[model samples]
Target: MNVRPAEPMFVSVPPRPQRLLHSEAYIKYIEGLQADSKYISNWDKQLRANTENTPVPDQSRLPTHWLGNGAGNHGSVVNALWMLRDFMMKDALGINKTI
Candidate 1:
């Protein structure tokens, strides 16, 4: 038997339970738990930043502007996430690993 990493595999589809709240976000949260601390924090930061500010994609600012600051949970979520940096660095460097 051989397993080829690049070989295409087919999967059967299963319908999700109708009662689940946020199927995608829940999956993302779980996947983050499986990753290292660096990946979890940095990935969240990257995703939040990459989110589009305007409906017209790149037109909100320049096509290259960093839109992370105002992606909007009424402007609160982004602020709170960045605020974590005030107490400690995201890398958790020089601190206990269990932190």
Candidate 2:
């Protein structure tokens, strides 16, 4: 499903403005993102609107859970989301190949 981003949500591969190797820039960026920031609220509103008639989704999983760290706690989730954003940007940044 296509979910519009709440923000630009760009995570540049290798980060355009270089910072410490520790990558505090990545950490700070995702720290501000939330499940609601990824159009999850839109999905939720649609679901609520359908509840009165349509059968809401069953046995379904939404990708937005990762935004809220549904799989684990803070650090791991942060890394996962950060990496995902970086991967999505790879092609546009001419980083299609990985070693």
Candidate 3:
């Protein structure tokens, strides 16, 4: 599913004005990551929208007792989301191969 970006996303890390690694491939990889990071904000928004609308069976809905316990807390969800998002962005940028 191709989702359009909702808003401009600034990369937390800026591009390296000068290549410190001195390898063409490495420099190219960094450039790709910079480009991917620019899309991160939109990507996250799409991911959130997708996840939010996911259908959960009423019978399987967690009770209040289980809401924030057993690895299902907000922190865990946020961490997992970030990890997945980072992985997807890196894959899109082809950093997976370089790594």
Candidate 4:
């Protein structure tokens, strides 16, 4: 009796080319928007407000674990499954924590 190697079960197809909206004119239009004084002033005001208004929370005062009635407790199974999928995908792709 002779044994044969298993054949491939699926064929790989090349991905379709992506059409990006980064033409020269579009880039120039974006650059013009960035250079506009009103846009610059709005962004500057937003940045200043964001930096000045918000205060960082004290991490030491935060809860160490999820509460029994919290959203995490309700979706614990879903979260565990998602974590498993992510771990498997990372292991398969050889990705590190930094990635």
TM-score of each: 0.23, 0.22, 0.23, 0.23
Model 4 backbone overlap count? 0
TM-score of 3: 0.23
lDDT of 1 by residue, 1-99 (tens): 988688558777898878856776678778767544655445445544423541333443332233355435545444443444433454555477766
Kindly list the per-residue Cα lDDT of model 4 for residues 1-99, writing each as its tens digit: 989998999979989998876876578666767544665334444334432364435544434343344335436533443444456655865766547
* lDDT of candidate 3 over 6-99, digit per residue (tens): 8757657877688555666567655657553655244555456544565434533333343344335435544444445557766777965787
Residues 1-99, model 2: lDDT tens digits: 999768866866784786656456577655756865864234555334422454424324334575654435535543455456556555554755553
In model 3, what are the clashing residue pairs, if there are any?
Answer: none
C-alpha positional error of residue 16 in candidate 3 after TM-score superposition, expressed in Å: 57
Worst 10 residues of 1 by lDDT: 54-63
Candidate 2 Cα errors over 4 Å, as ranges: 1-75, 95-99
User: Per-residue lDDT for 2 in model 4?
Assistant: 88
Pick the winner on TM-score between candidates 2 and 4: 4
By summed lDDT, the worst window of 10 consecutive residues in model 2 runs over 50-59
Better of 1 and 3 by TM-score: 3
Give the Å error, residue 4, model 3: 59
In model 3, the runs with Cα more than 4 Å from the true position are 1-75, 95-99
Each model's C-alpha lDDT? 0.50, 0.51, 0.53, 0.52
Report the Cα lDDT for candidate 2: 0.51
Q: Whose lDDT is higher: candidate 2's or candidate 4's?
A: 4
